[model samples]
Target: MRNNHNDKPQWQPATMTIHGGKQRDEHGALVAPLYQTATFAFSNTAQGSARFAGEEAGYIYSRLGNPTTDELEARIAQLEGYPAGAACATGMGAVSAAMLAFLEQGDHVVVADAIYGCSFALFSHLFAKFGISVDFVDMTNADNVAAAMRSNTKMVFIETPANPHLKIIDIAAVSEIAHRQQARVIVDNTFMTPLLQRPREQGADIVIHSATKYLNGHGDVVAGLICGSAEDIELIKMTTLKDMGATMSPHDAWLILRGLKTLDVRMERHCNNAMRVAAYLQQHQMVRSIYYPGLAEHPAQRLMGTQMHGPGAVIAFELDGDIATARQVLDSLELITIAVSLGDAETLIQHPASMTHSPYTPEARAKAGISDTLVRISVGLEAVEDIIADLEQAFTKAQQLKTIEQTEQTEQQGEPLTYG
Candidate 1:
């Protein structure tokens, strides 16, 4: 929307979720109609030339922009309280565009040691080949980030309530360090979403999300978003997004737009269920370590509480035994899904070491805090009691099977096994 004297009223979160940044069609459809066309028609050659010359606001092709996608981007920007944003075909699309948009061949990027596996690969491989250097640092300590910053550093990238481990990074602290070096700060707010944590408000220059996960919430679409100032988004739109052709489809954008309407309430239930599940796991004998920041024992509890409204749905815990036993417990889960993706309505669980982060070397995985015995669960909207009951039974089954396996191994070795 262009700036005008009759600007719409800015609503609060609840009200915005239902009515913010809407582009009403002539039919007055309550839900935005899916404009599934690839090309838009102009009234005349002069009008088309005007659009191409930037004198008019109009979409020429779906690859550059689509009405449906624009509506979603507008809504996301509104929710993030940013001047502009871009919706992309997939989560990595947004990540790649945001990085390539600002980075030059000799520029350096400082990133948190923990991020999505693909993000690490993109930085370590593709970006490296182009002469862009990246430093992966322990961002939990603000000083570590400050120390990593260089005169050549152009961006500081981080993920809060970070992937798999749920380590909370102080966005304000890192942003403070980056701004001193004249570097931009970009944060992946996938885990907590804007409802729980708004990174832009915490001094971050840009915010990105895997809209496929919590943003969609129904496991139906793969999408991403980048939120920042209009000038930054425009640079990405005209270059990386347009040339790479990572534009979100009209249908996918529509689905994500639908998701925005319920994000506030769904996040509320997600946080509530996760807190209950994390509390239950902490006291369980089979659980060796709990990685939910909501727990008081978590190293980042104070910082997390200050930065975010809640800990969110994803929780990581390590087992008392080996990878075999962890797999056994995951396989034994009847209610919780054994899928890799998170933020679905159904409970989903997976081992990051063998699943998401399998592409990384053992040392790399270790540095990222992904362990063989670790299991990450995306707590769902199910009744807290039922979710806990399912885990309880699975843990009991895992222990029994693990004991049997140990006994058999002992017998094979001809060692007399004694009772503990």
Candidate 2:
């Protein structure tokens, strides 16, 4: 049974992370026990049939349900302020399950122009093969979303502080527009986990998370979660999740359960470190442009403390030079790891054009405002000063490389290089 928070004073986020969906251990253990098994044994054939028929609430198979995974789902759902949730093997599993469950052939989906690279590929390439049409639009302006909706538009997908660029979309405004046309809003809440922003409370119909990132808060496990009303979650579980076989492993679920206990505090450090990193990038001469909501110069800075509790840990910026310059800086960095994923204890930096968003064609990426020179970083739990110092040295080395390259070019041409 779920813990009854209503019986006591309302739990805060930190408390909720530790104890929200947890049940007392009948064995008098401090931690919830993991139910690692393929299937549960029924009392009798009649009981087995009843479970298969959904006439009784009991685990039939690991794919259909597991006690450990169930607790993870319940914890996330409660954190999202939703009635139910489904855990998946990966973040894309959650995205596909949520969309495929509700969408049908000939259905049109309106989506944010900028989102995770894999998510964009899923809709543009795979969905087309199934006869579903999609329109990628700028959700920052609610009017763009309104204009894109159609009579057959069954869903609208978005990512606030959109991937790689930190573009802030107005969740409530888009939700209002989509709801008017009978479309449900599915929000990818990976960047700003429920600890930072609850999309359901902001009018989103469904919320998705890459449990591989912030939810797991470790580089070890890869998983996903979807939270929504009980009906929607049931629909997803019965359809895509059940048939696709993307259910999360019991071991992974248990790791995430342990990770969630530290989520509230980790998010605090992430936000704090990110704000400082963003500020440093803003004043740096080599950073041509920075896209972090915490910075006052960001167009969507106003959304902070209103739609979101804090400006999350991810930051995207452009260097003074071209893509080569960005690569040089990345290669020169000594401290931050050159990696694709985020929300781990160690800082990670990657080039969106070549790494994460490579699925998008050049034209599509341009339209989405993801420049070839853009660098995205997930500020980690390291000392803020050390992170800045590493970035500072990297930028200096990149500048030195640029000067040497210019000199070599001038020598090869037998003349000084000139700039317009």
Candidate 3:
């Protein structure tokens, strides 16, 4: 460990994650120090001028850069195999800043149709209001994506194993197509995280993350990250992040750094627990469909195996009944919390139609394969048997509710009622 700036060793991923971005002070403490100051004082006016003029390198203000944030950025960049990274205040902030950096008025963007609901709203509502045109396409189909591209197309934005539906897209293929047309490929890697997939190695020009999820591993902090080449990162940071004021706070950055140290271990458990839970749900009589890439029945199983190191923790399944039955299951569950966010240590669940995707009309929701009965579960690091027991109890409760409803209908009609 020579601390050579030019020649770092090619250590394994686990080692890199823990020790990659450490710059120690004179005390030589093992952990990186948090530089909490708002401004950096210069030795002289000439030195300050050089730092400001791009002739030298150093931090002038916390808004621009801080040692704690720099360490977090460096660790993430190394994990994602990128030259540089920019940390932002929130995931939406990262998405907005990155998109605004390269796109201008009258420019067109080809985006994946089944993106995060808020993201879809941002593009369809906010970006459209600014004169930037967007075409939504099924990114899983390469031909459709290529067809959607226009002469003014500046970017192809996608989210693999897309939110809620778990649709898979060929990142390398789309990147190649975009490059041929002189467009950039930006991938939202929030769902998969760096432990599961690295979009940069697969040819994406930029990778973004909602560090509020898996990166923090706790539900306490909200943050965002973007990684790419040094030139591209600096360009976006100077223009969008600086002007828009979406910079991450030093305290949040410190929390993310602490979470990063255990990312590999946490993700392993998440994948393991999720696979077992998905298998159990697939065999349930009340479950209409189960969507988890770890299941061999998944359409994207083969591709996910090829591209990602592990299947993610989130699983979406539809109930055989209606929205009421879905609500019953959520209410009966004793262990898992019903919540919007995911990737925390505790198991969580939510219904997409009435909660996350309520903004979308029925027709729009159907197009994205989101039905009223669809329920999403974010498996946590709980014991497999206990999680299964909770589900079994929930199913029993749902059956009882159906029986009581049938009895009430029979009494009202004054005739025999069929259980089917």
Which one wins on lDDT?
A: 2
Q: After superposition, how far is residue 162 of candidate 1 from its true place, in Å?
A: 0.8
Tens-digit lDDT track for model 3 on 151-217? 9999999998888878889898899899988899999999898878989878999999999999999
lDDT tens digits by residue: candidate 2, 1-420:
434232222888788889878876667667878888988999999999999888998888999999889888989998989999999999999999999999889999999999999999999999999999999998889999888989999999999989989999989999999999889999999999888899988899999999999989999999999999999999999889999998999999999999999999999999999999998999999999889988777877677787898889999998899989998999999999999999999999999999999999999999999897899999999999999999999999999999999999888889656899
Clashing pairs in 1: none
Alpha-carbon deviation at 412 in model 2, angstroms: 2.7
- Residue 378 of model 2 has an lDDT of 99
Kindly indicate the candidate among 1 and 3 with the higher lDDT: 1
Candidate 3 residue-pair clash tally? 0
- lDDT of every predicted structure (CA atoms): 0.88, 0.92, 0.88
My TM-score estimates for the predictions, one after another, are: 0.95, 0.96, 0.95
Runs of candidate 3 with Cα error greater than 4 angstroms are: 1-9, 44-46, 416-420
Judged by lDDT against the true structure, how good is candidate 3? 0.88
